[model samples]
Target: MTSNPPIPMRPIRTAQSRFPWHHFSMRFSSTPRGARLARRLAGERLDAWGVPYGSDTHDTVTLIVAELSANAVSHGLVPGRDFRLRLSAEGTTLRVEVTDTRGEKVPALVEPSDNLDGGGEGGRGLLLVAALADRWGWYPCADGPGKTVWAVCSASVLAAPSP
Candidate 1:
């Protein structure tokens, strides 16, 4: 009989294990007011998470939430349905998710062109989201209708996790 050596097991290190995990979610009407609320609520939650109200992290996350929510209202709105906003924090990363009942209207990234109109602000919402978020993407909602657009912002530009 041959005996096999025991395999060493490594500990799984996750943000949940290193720091307190925070999450917030709310459903809002698919209207302009809802987009505004999403942005405001995200900022409030980040403040509660100890990021401070006017810190860079807070500002970036707020902008991401605003842009994503606005996109949902303008492009993904489905009559009689509401949109959802979710925020989660783990370790040095904060994530934002906006879900609307229009799975067919998935967001696409547009290349930056010299002729783009922004006047130094940004060409569009997704463009601002792309510039601000360390990472961003979209996926079909698990429960029922629509898709979820998500963004992640890191504590610092250098601290962004590799793709």
Candidate 2:
């Protein structure tokens, strides 16, 4: 009888492990007020999700959300069309996705050429998003109405365990 050593057992990493998609979708008017509501409601939503207000993850996600939603209102607003926002947690990853009705005008990483968008301002929105997100990106909305701006956050409240 021949006996073989047991095979080494290592965990396999899957995309699902990195981003579990729990969805919260709502439509808001394409206005400055909508943008403000997006940021405010993000805090409320996070609290309901067990992330609590003022927690590191909550704050990070909220800021990213504000920037994205602001961009939606400013650059992607379409008459009579509202914008949508969704937030979900996949394991230790927090995902923020904002959709707006301007598919032709896609977002990109822009370099700030000057410090003069205004006093004490300029090129800071996306800058903050880039700094806070572990991996951030966007894609055309599959529904064909607009584009989706997304960012992933490493949850400060509950980190994903090592595989």
Candidate 3:
């Protein structure tokens, strides 16, 4: 009779455990064009972080960026000032942040139905953000006279091994 040696046990690593933190930040003009650019750049950055274009994680993050950027341009715009976009990924979490120099105009999440019933063309951005993001909020910027709106979405795909 032959006896096989016991196989050595190894700790299993999850997708969240294997992924390292990644960050991207940039400032854009407080204009419609700048907002568009921010969304495009965010998509590219997600691709670089292994989130892949067209994936759910990629799309969600991009949409959040688009909405936040648009709000910054339309509501938070300060002449001669630019807005800032920051993206950070750690494990299964992806965070999107948009900062503009308008501390007075804080965002609020209102019922979407209310706006739609009134035949309003806008005012649903925050509602969409609330639906899509696992968690979101805003705070006054620590270093400047402005505010930063942020949202976080869970990206299970971020844990998948890169092909």
Candidate 4:
């Protein structure tokens, strides 16, 4: 059998094969459980895309997306509104994007404050996201409220085994 066989997918806004988008998305209640579900579902979807459960690609992507989703629930929460998680694997790039309805809470990569202790109640989530992601950033919604915190983990991450 050929290694790294092509993954099939439908066109999204005229998305092409080279731009092949293997995607899954869900809207979840703005709660802790919803954040957890986002993470689990991401792992499952990646598995369906040939990223093995314990593979580095799976674990890294799952963890980063989970942390970001959790932040969405904790900080960007809006009453009655849910958060969304979208995963897309194209060629050698995997993109994870999480959007919440709260427009005011602009996600940022905070600098570790002097008061920031190795042991603290908050502040580690995005730090971990930064460390794990090959490239990460956030952008304001072009046509509406809220922002999307997205991260891209390089395909080479899969070249290694999960620790």
Best by lDDT: 3
User: Considering summed lDDT, which 10 consecutive residues are worst modelled in model 2?
Assistant: 6-15
Candidate 1 has its poorest 10 consecutive residues by lDDT at: 10-19
User: How far in Å is the alpha carbon of 46 misplaced in model 1?
Assistant: 0.8
lDDT string for model 2 (1-163, tens) is 9995642333424534643444567889999999999899888766655565766767888899999999899889999999999988666678888999899987777776576755635456777788888877878888787898888887443333434
lDDT of 1 by residue, 1-163 (tens): 9995643332323433322577889999889999998888788776666666766666788888989988889889989899999998776677899999999877997754666565543438888888898889999988888999998877553222222
Full ranking by lDDT: 3, 4, 1, 2
**Segments of candidate 1 deviating more than 4 angstroms:** 1-19, 111-123, 158-163
Model 2 misplaced stretches (Cα beyond 4 Å) = 1-22, 113-122, 155-163
TM-score of each: 0.77, 0.76, 0.82, 0.79
Runs of candidate 4 with Cα error greater than 4 angstroms are 1-20, 111-119, 160-163
Which run of 10 residues does model 3 get worst, by summed lDDT? 4-13
lDDT of 3: 0.84
Clashing pairs in 1: none
Candidate 1: residue 70 Cα off by (Å): 0.2
lDDT of 3 at 147: 99
RMSD of 1: 12.7
Clashes of 2: 1
Judge candidate 1 at residue 145 and give its lDDT: 81
lDDT by residue (tens digit), candidate 3, 114-149: 455556667889998988898999999989799999
By TM-score, the better pick of 2 and 4 is 4
Task: Give Cα distance to truth, residue 107, candidate 4, Å.
Answer: 1.7
